[model samples]
Target chain A: MGTTGGPGGRRVGRPRVSQRPDSGLTPRAELLTAAADLFTTRGYAATTTRTIAERAGMRQASMYHYVSGKEELLAELLESTVTPSLTYARGLLADDVTPAEGRLWELCRTDVELLCGGPHNLGGLYLLPEVRAERFAGFHAVRAELKDTYRQLLAATDAGGALAKSELDLRTDLLFGLIEGVILVHRSDPERPVSAFAEATADAALRIAGI
Target chain B: MGTTGGPGGRRVGRPRVSQRPDSGLTPRAELLTAAADLFTTRGYAATTTRTIAERAGMRQASMYHYVSGKEELLAELLESTVTPSLTYARGLLADDVTPAEGRLWELCRTDVELLCGGPHNLGGLYLLPEVRAERFAGFHAVRAELKDTYRQLLAATDAGGALAKSELDLRTDLLFGLIEGVILVHRSDPERPVSAFAEATADAALRIAGI
Candidate 1:
C-alpha cells in the first residue's frame, strides 16, 4: 500500500489494488505483480525498473507514477508478505488460554500456509542479498519481532522443563528453520500441493521442537 | 582445486591453495577467495571480475589467468562447497555396517560441520538466484544427489514403518532443512561457535526424523 500522511505511515509506493475498489487492479498492483515476478525470477539487483515497467505493460516514465523506485517496490512486496504473518503471530501469542504447544503449532501451520499458498514464491525473495539493505530495515525489524514471538512461545512451552535457556533458544531457531524450509522445497518442486506442505511442516515443527 | 581432465573434471577456475606448495596461496586461490568474499557480501551479479581482482590484490588481466570468468568463479565456489559434502554423503550411505539411524546421525553431523565450519558462510552462496541458472546445473545435481542420500538413509531408517512414502519424503525434506537452517542462524549471529550450531542442528535433525 502507498504511504498515507503520517510520520510512521507506509512509505511512498503504488497504491494497492484494494485501495481502489471499482477498478480490478490499480496500476500500482500491476507494477507490484510485475516487480515480484521479476525479482523472484531474475532477482532484485538484476531486474531494472525499466524491465519491470515493460513487463507490467507500461512506459518507463509512467511506471514512476506507480512507484517511487525499485527499492520501494521491493520494500512493499516484502512488507505485504511479512506484515500479515507478523500480525497473525502476535495475535496467536496474545492468546494465553491456548497451550503454548498448540499456539506454536498454529503459528507454524499458518506460516507454512502463507509461504506456500501464494501464486508466486514470495518467501524466496528473502534470499536476495539486496533485501538486507538499510532501506529494508523496517521489514527486518518486523521479521525479528516475528522470530521473537516464536522464541517466547517456545520458552513458554518449555517452562518447567530441564532444557537450558541456550538449548531452548537453539530449538526455537530450528523450529523457524523448519517452517521456512518449506519455501526451498516449494521452490524446487512447485507442482506439489501447498496444503500438503503446510500440514507436513506443522507436524515437523512440533516434532523438531520435541513437542 | 583446478579440474583435472576427466569425465567430472574440475571446471575452469582458480587452483585451490592446497593444490600448491611453498606459496601460501596461488593467484587462483586468491581470486576464488576474493570472489567468494565479494559474492557472499556484495552479491554475484553486482560483483565484477575487476572488483574481484582488486580485492584479490592482482591486476585484472592477471586475474583471468586463474579464472575463466566471474561465472566460473561462482561455479568453483559452489562446487567446492557441495562436492565435498556429496562425497562424504556417498561414503556414509555406502556403509552397510552402520544402522540407518546411526548413518543418518553421522550424515547430519558431518553436513552441519561442513555448513558451519567454513570461515565464510559458504552456504549463503546457495541463496544466490544465479545458482538456478543452467551453468550451475552441476551444483544443483550434486545438491540433489546429496538430498537423495539423505532420503535413502531416512528411508532405510524407516524400513517397514507405517509411515507413508509421502510422509517419509516430507520428513526427509525437513531433516535437510533443519541441518541447512544453521546457515541462516549463523548468518545472523556470526559470533556464536560453529560447533554449537553443528551439534544442535544434528540433534534437531534426529528429532525431526524421529530417530
Candidate 2:
C-alpha cells in the first residue's frame, strides 16, 4: 500500500467464489483478511495461495490480481503488526515537550494494546524463520527503527541516566522483547481486557528500564 | 527420554546414506538432529518425513523405526526446550534456604541462557499453530508448571510485597515472556557471549518484579 517499493498494493474488485460468502471488504483488504486468518491459524508454509483465495471468496487467478503471491501477503501482514506503532513512535521521537519517561510508557502501552487487541496474534509471525528472507527486510528495518525510538526515550529517562552503553542496549533488548512478547500472554488468555493488559505491560516496561 | 511416558526414546544404530557423512550420532539422535535442523531452517510444515529421513542419512521407511512421524518429533523438540528449565525450577522450589529474589534471578538467568544458547532457536517453533494441538498437551502442562514456579518465586520476593494476585500474575507473564523472548535478540546477534546476556537478563527480571 505504500507509494514506493514493496510486494503489495490495492487491487480492484473481483467476482466471488460461489462456495464462500462475501465479507463486503475491498478485494485487497479481503485478501489480507483471509491471509491473516490462514497464516495465524494454519501454518504459513502449509498454507497455499489457492486456499487463501478460497477463504477470501475469490478465484485463485483473481486473487493474483490483488496479491503477487503468499510472500507478498506475508510481507504485508508482518508490516501491519508493526507499522502503526512505528508511525506513532516517529511522532513521539520528534516531540521534545513531553517527558521522555511518560512518552516511553505511553508508547509501550499503545504498542502492547495494538499487538494484543488484534483478532489474530500477528506478532507471533515474528518468530518464523521464513521471515528472515530478503523480502521481509523492509519489515525488519521498520521494526528496528521503532526499537531505536525506544532506546532514545529510555536513555532520556531519569533511571536511564548514568548507565553505560552496553547496559542501555541490554535493557532496550528486554524492554522491546517484553513489548512484542505480550502477544504470547494475550494469546493464552484472550479474554483479558486490553486496556488493563496494556497498562500492566507499560508498567513492566518502565520497571525493566529500571524506573 | 523418560522412564514413564512420551513419544521419544533411544533407538539402536543403523547404516546411513552414502552421500552424507556420518554425524557420529546414534540413529535416534541423528534423526532428532536432522529434524531440529529442518524444522528450524525450513519451516516445520514445509519439511517432510522423506526429507528429514534423507537428511539424517536413512531411508524414509526406515526412519519410522526410531520415530512414529513428524508430530512426535515436534512434541519432543518442544518438550526439550522447556524440560530442563522445568526440572531446575522444581528443585529450586524445594530449596527453602536461597532467598526467593536471588532464586528468581538465577532461574531467569538460567532459563534465558538455555533458550538463547541453543544451536538453533528452538524457542522459535513455539509460535507454530500446530503446537496448540491436543498432542502437545504434555509439553504445555510442563511449561505451565514451570511458570507456576516463577510465580511462586516472584511472590516470595521482598519487592513482591503487598501486591494483589492479579498484579503478580501480570508481572509473571512479563518475566516469563522476557526469558523466552531473548531468543529473538540472540538470534539477531548470535555472537553475543551467553554469560553476559544471561546476567543481563537476570538483572532485568528482578527490576521487572519491581525490585
Candidate 3:
C-alpha cells in the first residue's frame, strides 16, 4: 500500500504507508480500531472480518472497501505502533548527549518507554499466530529493521567504548529478550504500569552495560 | 482420560487409553504421532480430524474409535509435554544448593534446557486457540503452582539478601520472561540450535541476578 516517491528506477528510499488514511477523521478509523481490539483480545485467527465489520457497525462486504483484508489491517496496526517508535529512537540518537554511555542509556530508556508508554499494539502482534506465518512475511523485514536499530545502538556504544566488545551480541539479545519479557508481564496485569517495569529494567540494563 | 485412583480427588497418574481390547498399539500410536505432527506444523484449527485421519492412513470414524475428538487429542499432546517437564523441574529443585541464588539459577537453567532440549509441544498449546480457551482454563491452577515455585525461589533470595527487596517482583517477572522468550526464539529458527541462545541467555540472566 506504500508508494515510493523517488525518481524513476531509484531504489534509495522505501516509502512509508500513511498509517490510517489521508484524513484521520474517517470511518476507516473505526474499522482499524475495531480490528485492533478484536485481534488483540480474541487473537488474529479467531478474529474474523465479519466480526470486525459488525463491531464497527458496518456490513461485512463494506469493510473491505476501506482496507484490503485482515492481513493488511494487521499490517496497518503494526505500522501505526512500530514505525513511529522507531522514528523516535532514531531521533534520540542525534541528541546532545556527549558521551556514548549517555546515548546508550537514552536509547535504552526510549525503547523501554516506547514499550511501556503506550497501548502496546506490538504486544498483540507478538502474541498473534496468524500473523506469524508467511502470509505476512513482508512484516518480517520491517521487524528486522527495527531490531537492527537496537543493534546499531549497541555498536555505537561499543565504538565510543561505553560497552564491552567481548559481549555485544549477547548483550543485545538479552536486552531484546528483556524488553519482550517485560511487555508480556505488563500485558498479563494491566494494573501494573509499564513505567515501573521500564525503570527497573533500565537500571538493571545499565548496570549490566557497565554504564 | 486420566483417572483418580485415590479418594479425596487425589490422582495416581495418567490413565492408559490404549490398553483396551478395542484398541491396538499401532493404530493408537500412529493416530497420536500424526496428530502431534499436524498440530505442531499446520496448527490446531487448520488440522481437521479428517486431515489427521488421512495422514494416519485411516478414516475419521476409525479415529473416533481410538479417541473422543480432536480436542481430546490436543489435550493428550499437551499433557504428554507438560507433565514430564514438571516432574523434571521438581527433580532439579531437589538438588543440593546452599544459597537461594544458586538454586534459582539451577532452576532457570533447567527450565531453559527442558524447553530448548527437544521438540516443544507446548508451543502448539500456546499457539492453539481452543487449547487456550478450554484446556488451559483447567490448567490455570497448575500454572499458578508453577509460579509459586519461582515465588519461593524469589522469597529465598530475598531472605538471603541476594536481591534488593523492592526489585523482587520485577526480577521474578523478568526471569520467567527470559525463559519464555528463549523458547520463542528457538521456535522461530529451526535450522539453528537453541543451545547457543540458551547459554547466552543463561549467562546474561546470571549477570542480571548478580550471581
Candidate 4:
C-alpha cells in the first residue's frame, strides 16, 4: 500500500516493532481511524497530517506511505463511512423480496447503527463547512445518491395512496433528516449512549415515511 | 443608530441617498442579514468583515460601528435566530391552557417556519464549525434550554403511559432532530416550498411523541 517511485516521493519511515498482527488494524486503517477522530473533533481544516501521524503512532514520513495527503485521508474516511451504506441501500433497492416499508426500516436501522456504533463519530464530518467545497464534490454526490435511494423506497411505500406524489420528495428529505439528526445530538453530548437514540431515530424514520 | 465619539471612529462612508424610510431595515439589521447570508453560504471562517460590509453596502469601518467583530456578528445572528424561539418556547411552557401535545406541535410548526421561511436560511449557521467553539457557548446553552422545553412537553403528554420515562429524553432528541432536519433539506434544495415539509414534519413530530 506504500506510494513509491512517484513525483515528490521519498522513502517513508520504518514500521514500528510494537505493532502486533493481532491488533486487527493495518497501518492504513490506523491512519484512517486517527484522521477520523481528529477531523471530527478538531475539524478537517484544523487537523494536520503530522498530528494524524502522531495519533496513529507512525512517523510523519511514514504517514505518506499509507495515504497520499490530508485531503485524500478525509476523502477516504468519508467514503469508507458513507459508501458502505450506499452499497447496502443499492442492494436493498435491487432486492425484490422485501416490501418497500421493510426495506426502508432496514436502511434506517443499518444507517443509524453505522453512524452511532462507529468507534469515532465520523458522521459529523457532513456538518463541516469545508466538506461543501468543490474538492469534496464526490462525497456530496454519493450522499445525494443515497438520498435518492431513500426517495425510491419512499415512493414505493406510497403505492397505497398514503402519500401524494407531491409529498414523496419532501417526506424523503424528512426521513433522512430525522435519521441524520442523531449525529448532531451525539456531537453535542458525547457521553450519552447512542443505542437508545439510534433505536428511537429508526422508529422516527419509519414514522416519517408513514410506514 | 450611528456610533459617534468612539475610538477609531470616523464617518466611514456616504449614506446611500436612495435609502427609503419604508425599507423597514436599520443598518444594523441589514448587517445582520448580510452576515447571515455570507456566513451560511461562504462559512464563518471564510467570510470577512469587509465582505460583509460590501454585501450590506457599508464601509468596513462602519461595520465595526454595528458589530464588534466577525465572531460577535455570528453571536448576534445565532442569538437573533435562536433567542426568539427560546422565548416563545418559554411562553408556551408557562401557558397552562394548551395541552403538552398541542404545544409540541406548535413548537414544531413555529420552528420550521423560522428555519424555512427566512429569506437567508439563518438556521444553516448551526452547521458552521465555528459555532461549536467556546465563543458561541451561549448559543449552545440556549439551544439546550429549547430542547429541555421539548422534554417537558413530551413528559406532560405521557400521561396515558404511551411512552415510558426513559423514552421521553430520546424522543425529545428525535423530535427536535426531525424539525431541524428541515434546515439541512432547505440547504440542499432551496427552491422547494417548506410549508408542505413543515406540515408533514409537525404531523411526524406528534406521531413520534405518541400523541
Enumerate the candidates' DockQ scores in order. 0.47, 0.67, 0.27, 0.39
Across residues A1-211, which tens digit of lDDT does each residue of candidate 2 receive?
A: 2123223332422233433444557878878888898899987998889888866776799888888999999999999888999999988988999999999999999999889888888988888889999999999999998899899999998888768998898888889988877877776777988998899889888988987
Candidate 2 has a TM-score of 0.90
Instruction: List candidate 1 segments past 4 Å from native.
Output: A1-23, A158-162, B1-23, B158-162
Candidate 1 structure, TM-score to reference: 0.85
lDDT, candidate 2, at A20? 40
The positional error of residue A129 in candidate 1, measured at the CA in angstroms, is 2.6
Docking quality class, candidate 4: acceptable
Winner of 3 and 4 under DockQ: 4
**Per-model C-alpha lDDT, please?**
0.76, 0.83, 0.60, 0.74
DockQ of 1: 0.47
User: Fraction of true inter-chain Cα contacts (below 8 Å) kept per model?
Assistant: 0.53, 0.81, 0.32, 0.44
- Model 3: lDDT equals 0.60
Best by DockQ: 2
Which pairs clash (backbone N, Cα, C closer than 3 Å) in model 4? none
| i-RMSD per candidate, Å | 1.6, 1.0, 3.2, 2.3
Q: Write the per-residue lDDT of candidate 1 for residues A1-211, one digit (tens) a residue.
A: 2333323322223333123323356789978888888877777779888777755555678888878999999998888777888899999888989998888888888888887888777777775667778999988898788888888888788541456878878777788877776777777778888776777788778887888
Off by over 4 Å in 2: A1-16, A19-21, B1-21
Candidate 1 lDDT score relative to the true structure? 0.76
TM-score (all chains, Cα) for each model = 0.85, 0.90, 0.76, 0.78
Instruction: Summarize candidate 2's per-residue lDDT along B84-109 as a digit string, tens digits.
Output: 99999988988999999889998999
What's model 1's lDDT at A4?
A: 35
RMSD of each: 8.8, 7.6, 11.7, 7.0
